[model samples]
Target: MNLSEQHRDRTDIPNADWESHMRRLRPILDLLKEKDRTLGEWYLKGETAQEALQHRAYDGKAPAKTAIEALSKEYGRKNKDDPKTVGIWNGIRSDQIGASLSLEIDGGEIFPKSLEISLNEKNERRGSRLGDYRSVAEVLSEVVRTYDSFYVTYGPFFYYTNKVFDDRPGVSWMLYLPHVLTSSEVPEARALIPVTRDGKQQGTIIVSVTDEVFDVNNRTHVKAANDIEIRLADQDLLPRYIDL
Candidate 1:
């Protein structure tokens, strides 16, 4: 999650350096590549999935730097003001992996600087590839480290479960708050994973009730996530989440 300040600095005025924006985006692509080989490849954009796969900026397995530079130049030329979105995936039509990176410019929308990376829920192989909670946490933590995120959370796809989250806005397998909250502050400190940088604890990462990939269909997993949300709400920590 890139902060608004970062976006403001990057997308402000005639001096908006799209090349710098692309440079900053390099780490995210790199991180995705490290997680799964199929991630961070094809540049997808179109009205439909099949059409999106056909949209390409460069050919072959070019280095990220080269691809990003080319994409930056394209965005600089064509999509100056529109909200730009690009999906990422391996080029293979069969057994394809899906992920996306999107940026909302300074339009009338709230959270204009939002950068969303989500799995393609419709993909059958998603469960085998990115269905684990720990794997998801590692990916999210890297992003939190990369940019100034107000807060971050990850949960199973809603349809994967029968549980309903009516009390609060949502529940998740993990929650990232950009502040230090200890065991004393949050009795379940065992779940809190510290996000540190430069030898200092930058924020707190709260995992789900268990260490396993959260199976939303499992009553235990759903209950666990619900319980954590209630506990955090009771502690008034739920309101502390930055709404962005």
Candidate 2:
């Protein structure tokens, strides 16, 4: 039959009507208390599931001081070292949502032999001359560690990158920030290059923390580091993910 006729006929047939069809399937959506084994263990054992979840959710603002006491009642203190408990704790940490930067640095110079000469039989030679060197290497390294410490307190750090894409852009690193902050607040990434006594390239080097470019799911991960590259086209790059 025609489309309209087919629809009309189906409605007329009560058993075939959409309402009746849905009614038969409504029980599937009912909120039944399925025995969630995970929850059961926590509740029955009087474990710290609720407290742990709360702490993780609120960044350890209020911890469950009595969780171990309650959990010990059922699982006992020995079982507190159980893998299941550890897994639960890790899961809580993973669920903590926050933003962070992947900071990295590179560049700097390496020197080989400084001066090698022999004074014999009325022969004299001069040593190697000093070259231009960036004086900010030590200061920059300290800055990177400082920023890294600040972020680690809030969440875990991750590194990522792709060599193929990076070659075209030359040597570069990035710092990713969370959406909670604005780009203007985070300046362009920068570092002071160090010069070695031996002849070697010396300048502000870009260091990257992201070793692997692809994610576990094989998807290309993007970060604020990429944005920093875009923002700072050709200026004296400053630290990108700084608070000030």
Candidate 3:
């Protein structure tokens, strides 16, 4: 299987100050930059970096830093006429890398706050060596370490394999939870990988099915993932399975 192809890795953290969210974006932006330097430039819907260049947000050539600083100011502003409309909705992407980072900065929603980083199949095949559970788990662990993310899911895009959650892990290759849980909390077939940050065990990463990189086409792998999902639900570990 092409382990990294069509991968979607999402992470969720509780809502916090806007500054905290900007701080969280730094490392993630850095990670994307490692994939494609030009992807560091941030932009809003219906706007382009070249078009935004003349705007005050550019503030020099450092796209990532300046754009986030500009977004912070934007987040703090309010519209007297429509207070609900006063929010930030922006993202960073690169056509060259075929990867993008999308953020949900609105706080009025019922869902846990989250962000998603997606890599198209072509880019994944060329740039990523995520052929096993350990490699993909490490990538997810990086986000957890940077954001202290309480929840994360990494797997191929649902459309790529015609897989859906359906009250199970179905398409997800791995799930990360900040709270510690024993192996007894998961299915016998699953692997509970411990994620450490700053020398402390920050959370547990539940690998779906097997150590082999998850293949959505593999019925065994999909069922193994679903099995772990059911077990986690039984232990009340998955309060909101689909956060992003």
- Largest lDDT belongs to which candidate? 1
Clashing pairs in 3: none
Per-residue alpha-carbon lDDT of candidate 2 for residues 1-244, written as tens digits (9 for 90 to 100): 0000000112222221222322221221121112111111111111364554432211122223344334334344333223222112222122221111111111111211010011111110111011011211232222222222211100012222432233223122322221122324334333223322235322223323233321212223333344444453334233222221
Per-candidate count of clashing residue pairs (backbone under 3 Å)? 0, 10, 0
> What residue runs in model 3 are displaced by over 4 Å at the alpha carbon?
1-20, 32-96, 106-111, 122-131, 159-171, 209-211, 241-244
Pairs of residues at least 3 apart in sequence or in different chains that clash in candidate 1 = none
Candidate closer to the true structure by TM-score (higher is better), 1 or 3: 1
Clash number for candidate 2: 10
| Tens-place lDDT digits, model 1, residues 77-174 | 65455555433444544524455566444333344355555554444323535545566566667767766666666665562243234433334567
The total of clashing pairs for model 3 equals: 0
Which whole-number lDDT from 0 to 100 does residue 93 have in model 2?
21
Residues 1-244 of candidate 3: C-alpha lDDT, one tens digit per residue: 2112111223353333334455555665555455445445544332565554433322233334545455545544653121111122223343434444555544444444455766554333233434456666766777777556757777766623443445333326777776677876664537788899778898888777564555566677777777676676777666444543
Q: What is the TM-score (0 to 1) of candidate 1? A: 0.69
* Model 3: residue 44 alpha-carbon error in angstroms: 5.5
Please give the lDDT score at residue 33 for candidate 3: 53
Tell me model 1's lDDT, rounded to 2 decimals. Answer: 0.55
Error of 3 at 197 (Å): 3.4
Specify the poorest-scoring 10-residue window by lDDT in model 2. 1-10
Query: What's the lDDT for all of these models?
Result: 0.55, 0.23, 0.53
Question: Which candidate, 1 or 3, has the higher lDDT?
Answer: 1
